[model samples]
Target chain A: MVAPDYLQVLVLAAVAIALIIVTIEVVARIVRPHAPNPNKYETYECGERTIGSTGVKIGVQYYLYALVFIIFDVEAVMLFPWAVSFKEFDGVLGLGTIIFAEVFMFVGILLIGLVYAWKRGVLEWQEM
Target chain B: MVDLMNWAGIYDTIEGFLSGLGLSFIIPLTLYAIAALILFGFVAALVLVTTYLERKILSDIQVRLGPMETGGRRFHGILQPVADGIKLLQKEDIMPKNRDKLPYYLAPLVVFVPVFVIMGLIPLGFIPLDIASLNKNLLVAADLDIGILAILALAVIPTLGAVMAGWSSRNKFTTLAMLRSVAQGISYEIPFVLAALAVVLAAGSMNLSEIVKAQSGLWFIFLMPIGFIVFFMAALAEIHRIPFDVDEAENELVSGVIVEYSGMRFAFFYLAAYAELFIAAALITILFLGGWAGPVLPGVMWFFIKCFVIIYVIIWMRGTLPRVRIDQMLAVGWKVMLPLALLNLLITSSILML
Candidate 1:
């Protein structure tokens, strides 16, 4: 089956953007000066000679935050369908309250997780 | 309601004209080409105007004349952004030694493409003149069902590009900057989505145009002021604007994940930033400010008027506020904004139920 009109337009738009980027880059590559020097290739270090490896270990605190973010992000995703259909449910008897309560329990559990992270100092940024 | 000029009617007229010439087979292609051109031109113009406006506004705030030399003295450097674009196009492209060649080359494209795609999802304005046509919006490329969700989902891709740029650069500062940006981006995003969810709950639709239509009687800003504030603050952080721009703290990280890029690649990052800024402002206009809704003026005109006002406020904040510390930024996102967004959601849902 053929894709819907909007999807077709979206794909066409994406292609057009890719074409624009390519054309611009190609023109720039042709017109721009090309002189490569060793000094220019070196990483910028604010005038000081670079020392040590670039892959320095960061605080594990970031990873912990990422973990928490994943949980909340999922919660947000799950909440969208309910949020959209809420009006329909509200028009029906008894169903609106049930759906609202279910979402409340779901979000409440996630909020508890967030609070747990907060209490555990997982949200705190530890300076390295 | 006053009858506004209908883009959909014009589109159908064009399609019929083409069909009369026995060009019906190429109609879709032609329409798509036209849509792409209009969208690109609009976004490019927005970037140019906003860049110049930003400099002029910041300069005025600092009691200085900005961009008086470009274009002509009479135009007050109106052509400054154009000059900058041409200069960047002709600048030398630099690649650092021992960098990850693939991602280094691909990073800018990754950062840019999603922003362009998100532009397609925005309903610029509405004209109810074409009752027969599928879309009534002025010039939206795709009025998708999951409009806001698609926008939010696509918005996350650029952060990946930032991380890739930082990691591939083989530079300490870039890595640190990307990490900070990732932390900040993810932190702000929760409240942003939650705040937007409050709007969705109130409007009872995920489609952006419908959300705008829902605000016909009363704008969501009046109904949920806390949600608007939370969304706006979270949006500022998401775009890495000043006061929430710790990642690109020039005095510290030396231009953040983009430190090593030069020429057109560097230009891509700036273009993406401006495009995202426009999207944020437009989203605020659509979600909270009764998009395209006003007396007398056409919907498209009103939509843009609201957008520019919001954009001006953003620029004013940039001129006024200092960058918050990274810790403070995260604390605001998580501790303050997140709870407030949740509370807003709770209140909105309860009110709707009642």
Candidate 2:
């Protein structure tokens, strides 16, 4: 109950932050100068007028990094509960060794995935 | 209800004072407002101090006077941040032509709110004057069961804001910067989480206050030096501090994802960056340097002292180290930091088993 109540406080904190940002923006809007020119709205490319469409193709290497990130992110999440309860396992008879081995195996497989990604050049951000 | 009040010392006092006036019904709402105000003020003050210190320290490092004209030459420009903030508030809010509309307007808010929420989760040590004789961590807004996890989870969110800013701006530089930011952010987060996980394994608790309490004898930094280094490096990268700020490489990306933002919206990103810096420093203190644990000084003082020291190191790196290329940044994150963190976790867990 206390934890949930504290969570409510967390939500309240978030709401407060949003409100503060909005308040600042609204005040700024009222007080700040506004002299909008078409030239000022031009896309900034080191003060050079941007040539052609601003819609550019990003390298696919970014997607590869994201894909690899997800796999390891899930591994990290799975390890969280095990890491928190790791000491508790030590108190029981042989549970420590069993869980340790299981985690090792689980993480070992992920490490292999990481290595595979490295070998396949997924980790390398090749210049496109 | 009584138990809840007892845990929050100041909240209890305020509630009691209200109830004495037959106003118990409004206590919860009043406390919530007060808590929110306190947190906001704390974060705002932190940003101001850190920003000023950063300029002063960087100037010292580079052998120059920083901000002497703004506050006063005698006081060394202490009021410069306040002046800068007011100036920023009065700047024209620029809206780009042909923008995506929604994400552009929402990007700064998305970037700022998560970082602000993270400050609430950080345990800033107990109330030194324990008026109620209750040994509760009254400083942290939410002492969640998954405190560390929650912090880490919240840490990864600002990248979405960067991406939104980049893509929605209809600027090529921002789009490219957004791609690099996402890749870099996600890559460094692994090692950061793993390094924190190593500490969790040692402390056997995800709650940050519990982690600090577990370190009463010896700090985890000594027990697992690799974890500390990895965490610190990954954190530097995660927060986009220099030597790892490729996404914001001003020469290349023209301010990167925030290239298009102006005025108050721009200030949101600026505030968020400083706030993330504070949170990262606080996390380092809590995870490695032993949060709020020190001699002579009070726990709150010790906590802040440790945080500022880490912040000093971060700013020093910013002044000294050259930014790495995006390719090199990703390579270091994936190839080097991740394996080191996993090794730290394996060693810590194995040692615990023994």
- Model 2: pairs clashing at backbone N, Cα or C within 3 Å: none
How close to the true structure is residue B68 of candidate 2, measured as C-alpha lDDT?
Answer: 91
- Could you tally the backbone clashes for each prediction? 0, 0
Instruction: Give the alpha carbon lDDT tens digit for every residue of B219-290 in model 2.
Output: 999999999999999999899989998898888888889989988888889989999999999999999999
lDDT of each: 0.86, 0.86
Off by over 4 Å in 2: A1-6, B1-26, B133-137
TM-score for all models, in order of appearance: 0.93, 0.94
Pairs with steric clashes in candidate 1? none
Task: Give the fraction of true interface contacts kept by model 1.
Answer: 0.64
Model 1: how far residue B94 lies from native, Å: 1.0
lDDT of 2 at B110: 84
Instruction: List fnat, each candidate.
Output: 0.64, 0.68
How well does model 2 score by local distance difference test? 0.86
* Per-residue lDDT of model 1, residues B1-354, tens digit only: 001123336557767899899988866666666666667777788899999999999999999999898889998999999999999899998889989999998888888888888887888886545565343434477777788988999899999999999999999899989999999999999999999999999998888989998999999999999999999999999999998999999899989999999888898888889999999999999999998999998888998899889889999999999889999888888899989999999999898888
